[model samples]
Target chain A: MSEFDLIRRSQEVICAPGARYRAQCVLGIGDDGAVLELPPERQVVVCTDTLVEGVHFPLDTGPAAVGHKALAVNLSDLAAMGAEPAWFFLALTLPAAAPAWLEPFAQGMARLASAASIWLAGGDVAAGPLNVCITALGLVDKGRALTRSGARPGDLVAISGRPGAAAHALALLQAGRVPDARELAALEFPQPRLELGLALRGLATACIDLSDGLLADLGHILEASGAGAELELGRLPCAESLAGLPEPERWRLQLAGGDDYELCFTLPAARAGELDALQRRCGLELTVIGRITAQAGLTLRAPDGSPYRAERAGFDHFGGYRGEGSPAAS
Target chain B: MSEFDLIRRSQEVICAPGARYRAQCVLGIGDDGAVLELPPERQVVVCTDTLVEGVHFPLDTGPAAVGHKALAVNLSDLAAMGAEPAWFFLALTLPAAAPAWLEPFAQGMARLASAASIWLAGGDVAAGPLNVCITALGLVDKGRALTRSGARPGDLVAISGRPGAAAHALALLQAGRVPDARELAALEFPQPRLELGLALRGLATACIDLSDGLLADLGHILEASGAGAELELGRLPCAESLAGLPEPERWRLQLAGGDDYELCFTLPAARAGELDALQRRCGLELTVIGRITAQAGLTLRAPDGSPYRAERAGFDHFGGYRGEGSPAAS
Candidate 1:
């Protein structure tokens, strides 16, 4: 298919019926731009992320999973900001116009877009190395968008769902070991915590999604808020598959391995009960893994009450750590 | 620099003051997402465009010009939509962490952003072949945005600024001939008609930007409006440099050349005087070039009333045209 044809087909796939974003979109696709009506009293939140082949995903990864993860990562960012997914603009570059790849990619992207109720507003497609860059826009009430700079000392630090399964799956895949179904699912189609994010909008003091593992992402919250964190290593919710690994290896995946896409947030200590109630209501695991600290650095406490030192914080694109033992690192 | 440090430096480079978007931004860089307050009665207009090395620009093109054109193309889309440029999100991919490239690229982007009053809201950077994808957002009053599908029979077609100068420049550069200063400026720094677009919001019946040459882009407006157009080839305003070329070459550049970030629109014949007034008021050149017709295909008339046939409509990324005689095609 031509670039234009692919765009038209992708639009059809992404803007399926029951799209909640339709009401807000005055115009979608085909125009020089898309027009969206901002609902009264709502603020716009915008974020962008790019996924590169061989960097963000394996070259052999399925197009559908690639598309899903591309949008999911941006959604996770919006979720971190306590914003509701509304609209997205995609810039897709590919080595060639392979219909086989484009069709499944569009389907995967559409499935998640439909689930999130975010419509594809506009996009550009070009011939180049495979890359997908998505800029997602969401809406939140005025002054209610959670920011990383709002964490405070003594606040309870929490995480929605478990972290590190994606990393474990990546590790296994790189080591030529096929992961179990659950691990494969985590690696391929990890869900963004949209509902949990919306639920925490007015309740959470600060928030971030674990794109770069728990420790690294939490470090962002701490640095932004001018605080520290004390993570209870024992309380970390690890994947069931990770339970078989040695303690140090398991902890490495939990603390430093990336692409978890789980929300790591802070809330006042008094709201711990409310959080529990929210967890039960939403039927999603919400675990208190740590607490914001007055100190200016991260500290990990073991079950034996001793400080734990990690080999590294997280994956850094330009750092010395190459993806030697990891699947794909971005 | 690490990704985080690069991000911080980029934020500093892109958020230089006098940014008109700052007022609407509830939060800018350093957050998971940028928060924006929608003006009370405005709708958001968004457009995305990606520029790939060698496809969008000459491989030796300066980083600054590449960055400027990346955002400029998206701004041109907003201008086509009669939207006021407000903010933009960037996804920059680089082969390496070269400060020499990043510094100038950011400066070029920020310079235009400051001039247009659009702020850099948020972005992502990754390692890959150099590519710059920009998603720009603008604001338009309710139902006032211009669209391509609003033309009518007898509407006078017009163009803002001369078309094809950029394409001519590219052709000359590809032939190893140095373009004049004017031609170079047209190629590297085509200014988007932001003011003209905002002014034409309520006046123009239909609009599109000449990114894919006049014929192809005008065809879009015609097809969208279920109409056609008859161009007076003699009426096309050719650049002085192009005027020296043979008639066929000159016409080819004017009719089939791409990369002219100029607005082409149709307006009611009775509104011609109003457009003239707008041209004078905005100090812009608005030339009447054609008229919309009920017929369903575009036709070109020579000054002697003979039919004018172009070799092709415009540049197509996946088409047979491979920028053979043009330095920058996209």
Candidate 2:
């Protein structure tokens, strides 16, 4: 598809209407900037993500995956705050203006956008080394935003959707240990759990999207909430693809793999029924992975009742900070 | 300064109450993302821009200049549409974690943010080749967005603020031809004409920020509006800093240089009185550079009333695609 064609296709997907913002956005997408109407309430949720060529993905990654991931990640952020996605802006740079690359990438982007009912809105495209920055706008009722600092002691820590699959897939890829088509697909195109996030609104006390390894990401919640938690390692909702791997490898992958795109949240224990009801309504699985504690740091317990300490490391955005078993640079 | 101190210092400058979106923002800097009260009005404006190392700026440039330029550039897009900037998000990638580099950068950014009366809502920092992507949000009246596609054949071509100083500065920097301090200041910091854009609400037939050089950027307005015009080249405004340069050299810098951050627009001649009135109130100069014609493309005329044909290449994102007179890389 040509750049225009890609835009046309994606526009079709992003044009869906559902939840509306109080400040009714008059014109979105297809312009220099997305236009919004400000009501008296005057509150909006805005988030942005930048995906670099090699740092965010492999150099030879396909355009479609690149496009989908770019928007999906931003939407995940909106979900974390119980906000409704409204509009988005894209700033795209490419080493060269390759129509072939632009077309499929936009097609993939449009497919995800249409499914999520997001509008392509307005953005800029220019020539440079490949980098894509997507800034998304979402809406929430005034004074109703969920924040990372709201978790209380005794809150139940629950997760929405499966975790550790993206990490495992990345490990498999890096290890040159080929998985079947299904596993490979998971690694290449991990989905963001937007629905799960929106459904967790009143059910979660503190919530965050797991873009980093579970241990590292949960650490953020703990740090922000000023509380600690104990997690049952075996309770993790690891992907079924790991069933083929050795138990130890699966455990490590579940603990240390990043890019899960799942929701890790905390809420009062009394909301167990509500959580169950919401999960049933949404047709998604919920895992009671841990519980908030008065203590001030995380602890993982193994199946045999010993403290699980497998020496897992968190994802490192800076080079030279390596996680355990990370493939050495050639 | 520590990362936290840098953030604090910058926040003091950028997210002040007078900044554009302060009233509606619930959470500004020092959070994962800026949260705002999404007013009942459902319309908004969003845009993004990325400044890369060695490409958009020199590696040795001051952090404050980098930060200010980054946010200012994005704000220019909002100004083009007569929108009030409300919130901003940043995504920054650095080659290393150097607090020394970050402090002044944050200070510069915050200062601009404060002066613009907009909030620094949220951002992400990681390690990589230096890159900064700033996504800005703005509020506009529903259906009141000024777009590039509204110019008519009889429209009068008008502009707010001087142009070409930025390009001239780049040339000077590259050739080690540093002008006096005043000229250097223009090159280092170019202001965005936000108030002028709002004042032009009822006057401009079409508008855009002169980012990619006047000729090329105005071409976008022409293409979008399906109209053409003849530019009186002699009528173009040049910075006083260019007065000392040779006339031809001055003309070259004025016509072909980019990064002026001024508004280039078309207004109907009927609004001459209103334009004059606005100039009186704002104390900003307004110039009639040309007139829109039924013709299909742009025309240039010399001061002697003859056709002016000279190199008018603008900046392109692609490396070496339109290198013009700058020293070519080996």
Best by lDDT: 1
lDDT of 1 by residue, A113-184 (tens): 988988888899988889999999999999999999999999999998888899999998889899898988
Report chain A TM-scores, every model. Answer: 0.96, 0.87
Clash pairs, model 1 backbone: none
**lDDT tens digits by residue: candidate 1, B1-330:** 777778888889877588777888889877889999988888899999999998888889898899789989999999999998888888989888778888998898889988888888888888888889999999999999999999999999999888879999999889999999999889888899888888888789999999988888888888789898889999999788887888888988888887989999999999898976898987988999999989778888999999876777776666634222221111
lDDT for model 1, please. Answer: 0.87
Give the residue spans of candidate 2 off by over 4 A.
Answer: A1-25, A28-32, A38-43, A244-249, A310-313, A319-330, B1-20, B28-33, B39-42, B244-249, B274-277, B318-330
Question: What's each prediction's TM-score?
Answer: 0.96, 0.88
Alpha carbon deviation, residue B311, candidate 2 (Å): 3.0
lDDT of 2 by residue, A5-89 (tens): 3445545544444434423555555455667664455346777877887777767678888988888888888877777776777
Docking class of 2: acceptable
Q: Which ten residues in a row have the lowest lDDT in candidate 1 chain A?
A: A321-330
Error in Å for residue A158 of model 2 = 1.3
